[model samples]
Target: MQIPVVLLFLGLLTVPGRSQNAATEQNSATDGANAGEVEEEDPFYKSPVNKLAAAVSNFGYDLYRQQSSRTATANVLLSPFSLATALSGLSLGAGERTEDVISRALFYDLLNKAEVHNTYKDLLTSVTGPEKSMKSASRIILEKRLRVKPGFHSQLEKSYKMRLRALSGNTQLDLQEINNWVRQQTKGRIMRFMKDMPTDVSILLAGAAYFKGTWKTKFDTKKTALQDFHLDEDRTVKVSMMSDPKAILRYGFDSELNCKIAQLPLTEGISAMFFLPTKVTQNMTLIEESLTSEFVHDVDKELKTVHAVLSLPKLKLNYEEALDSTIKETRLQSLFTSPDFTKISAKPIKLSHVQHKAILELSEDGERSTPNPGVNAARLTFPIEYHVDRPFLLVLRDDTTGTLLFIGKILDPRSV
Candidate 1:
């Protein structure tokens, strides 16, 4: 059941920071009245978003493992949602074999075919729609000359709400144009992302996300100072450490995973969870292995909010990676070497590269919220000491839909 498909070069990028949605800032000004309208959601346990979330999470972990093996010493970050969204759009033009391959790779086979695409359509609209808390978007780029099937074009535009671009033949101009579009979309947080256009390119699919999440409870900037960040037990570098004595946080220790997990809420529907290894030299292999949709859901269910003196490094990072090996690990092997994308274009095409780049800038923002009188205050006894001074895994998620926006291991924030 081989499907005919084109060669794909998938590139992903992200910029996360302390500021609000830059892409939507202008829109909010023009559409101020509707900006405050609330978004509706189904119950978390019953929603199909959870199913897709699990699939993306598994794919993300698999991809992270591949990248980790290659760059063990460097920081790792990947946006599974971004990659999956792009791939799903590409799948619209795929023939039977190609479609099957993408379906298996993306865990789409587990869901009813009719439900999968439409659910993704809904998810994309909600995440990238008006009144978004973070700035994020994904799209597919094809050579201008290629004749895209009308059905594929209509579905891509209507369902995915993706903007398709035609390469202008001028490599430098096209490169500049691509970078400019990304810059405009991400509100200039990331610029000049593509250095040079690939000469052999037939089709390229990419996704980018930019988020500057403000903590619900702000950290004191005055208390932030340089402190030792352990790269390993033998190595330590000074980094700006942000501390709050009465930081209210959800805390849990996973005995089976052998890691301490803490969750901090962000404004809107987003939340960030950190997994710190008990030993300074310990890496994220175990935690990476344990990441699954149900496991993360269970972790949150088990975690209880507590009073803690939290000390965390002020993180600003930029990371890039290639995803060929990771995609190869999935069921879509033939796609890398030989496959037909006749539906996309009459010309023969094969994938050459799959790459990702991300930038995250996190800091204390806004006035601190006072703790409530009940559970938050009661848990203040002998406050837990959760200092993230070493290598750890951090996940940013949409608490409403249970979607994972970004996941990565911070080996050395000092490097970026």
Candidate 2:
């Protein structure tokens, strides 16, 4: 079989939260402080998950920036956390220059050697562990003929909680099995994830994340309507737009970056943030430049809860890309060329292909838009109107763990 490896990162954020009346009291107009609101401290920030999250998101941002440079007029999205987890599993079989390259590329070289894999073990377990909010899984697949080394096998089973699949020579059967696994992992949000099986495949690394959450403040569908989305300064297209007239969310502005930022809550301690340009033609460079882990943490701390009128295009997106150039750009060139995998097999082997696929679907489904029972609405404030009618960057994060679940740029929501 050809060495056609696939890294499928599926992030399914399903909004199914129980309807709750949002706080009707007007928020104080303070910049970073409210009279009695105290920010909750998250323990995961100093944990290995945070470090891993940082490294992975940084890699994803780097890849996004590079891809945007070449395809400046197209949409881009990927789950860096998924890519990192998949690669870390791949690293278990690598040694010598190959291991070093993967380590450096993921910035794992900066972490403690003894703790890295184990930390990943903890991270994976926590993420995929039983939670009402999200579901996640990762796997490494190999052909049945490839003999697994004893030491590698033990570590793989123990630390990674990996479910190994031995592919049979039958192409159709293999495709069905892979698709079944994908469907099971993603809770059926994704079906027929793999179009076809590659005839020449040696190993495949896959990671998936599924999240189902309810908006703390649901968008008023009664107010949602077809709105003009500026694809470019001169071009426009119509798309379903979600709106919340009395929306209350964490808000901030970065004058130096020339962008408006807002954080909307989702059930189970997750949040979706938007980075919108101040001008129609302003590139996302500054916002992209501000994607470091430290920067995000700072934003969370500095932003204040405020009332606002928010509007955004409802997004339904599916993205896939071959990473031949991304891997090289990220300086993991050794893997594509000469590197050691003695731990995995006795025969000389090297990576032949790397690919990623992602999917995102968002809407105000299965939730009530009207207020619960008989809650009375407080007098409205002169809310700042934040409309996302143009290209913007979005980051979905788990507030409890500071984990970035999804990140992407929507150049055109009308384009599937």
Candidate 3:
């Protein structure tokens, strides 16, 4: 299948008890923090399931925060401690079940929707002593679960079944509602729920993902400049390259096969590596054929260090993907059928609407709206190195898990 990847794919960081204390761990790497460097300490790094979870798109992704405009009240309560423990699985399944087929192929399908909620409720029993923030979160999850009826297909129906307005403009989404809901739920952790929502939104669209992560050792903004990025040898694209003097280094290779792998580390013993063919973007089959957990973790311990410059085209992608096929192929298929869902999904819910509306105001409401609003309009166009004119791949790795969280190959930029 010709997999169409969105450019500018972003991810959210989930922080627990102690924030990600990203003090550079490696002595060889930089000792101090850079301008935009964000210290991210994530316990999910230790989870095997999550290692593959982010990369595996087979399962449905719901952008649910403990609290939000998401009006559903779940009957099941998830204990904070258990939830945290459960989430640790994310890092564990990294390389092995990271693939769509492997990740979604198996599941806890035997459990009915109610059973799922009860299990979550049982886990909530472990939330005896959480901070007030954590307790409030628990209550919200219970409410969210109550709203998750198997019969419910679309979120509006599940939570606000009777509240949808057919006259609602496809483009006019109450962004504030979504944002406020998310901010409260995530405790201001994940911001900007979605930069843009697809206009072709439809039913079965119960969730959206809006995540942003910063490197622990951020590159100095001063060093960031226009660099030549090669999409293909003949096609030279100009892009932004965030460079620093030092970083975690590792030598990776696809022995007896053809691929490129590099262990790029994060602070606090966390790191991520990129694996591709010596020739990427040119012959993508090598990337497709040689991708696996063994392929991912089988980093060549002994390899040469090749000094090179890296330039990544600044890209933002807004994807309009249809998850129907993917969902049916995965474990959620029966949710729509008579045999499995007939009992709970008593409502014949055909996706009436699942449109996502996102807006990029460019400028805050009533500020002079001009490409170059200042007297420096002449100087504005002089430094236009941020133009993204090609395709690229983005992967977010959690060092604790040694897994790639989000993976997307962007061939288009306007979507963002």
TM-score quality measure for candidate 3:
0.46
Q: Highest lDDT, which number?
A: 1
Off by over 4 Å in 1: 1-43, 372-381
TM-score of each: 0.85, 0.81, 0.46
Q: How displaced is residue 156 in candidate 3, in Å?
A: 16
Cα-based lDDT for every prediction: 0.70, 0.67, 0.30
Residue 219, candidate 1: alpha-carbon lDDT: 78
Model 1 is weakest, by summed lDDT over 10 consecutive residues, at 10-19
lDDT of 3 by residue, 1-416 (tens): 11112121111111111101111121112333354444442344233333332222112111111111122211111111211222222112122223122223322221232233233332233221232212112111111112234332332233221222221333435444454554554456435554453443322232323323333334456766767655555766555555533322333334333444444433333343444344424543334333332223323223223322333333334332333443344343442242222222233332222222121111011112222122221112222121223443334333333333334444332333
Residue 181 of model 2 has an lDDT of 84
- The 10-residue segment of model 2 with minimum total lDDT is 17-26
Q: Give per-candidate clash totals.
A: 9, 5, 48
lDDT of 2 by residue, 1-416 (tens): 01112121121111111111101111221312466555443454457767766555556666666666667778877666666777787888898778888876776765676788887777666555655446555567676567778788788877776666767888898779977887787778667556767655566655555454577657767888999998888988999999887666667666656777778777667788888887879988657755755466656765566657778887777776655566666577777567788888887666655556667667765245543444342333455678999999888876755667777888898753
Ranking by lDDT: 1, 2, 3
* Residue runs of model 2 more than 4 Å from their true location after superposition: 1-44, 209-213, 365-382
Comparing 1 with 3 on TM-score, the higher-scoring candidate is: 1
Q: How would you encode candidate 1's per-residue C-alpha lDDT over 322-409 as one tens digit per residue?
A: 5666677666677777666667666776555565556776798743555444554324435588999999999888786777788878
Top candidate (TM-score): 1
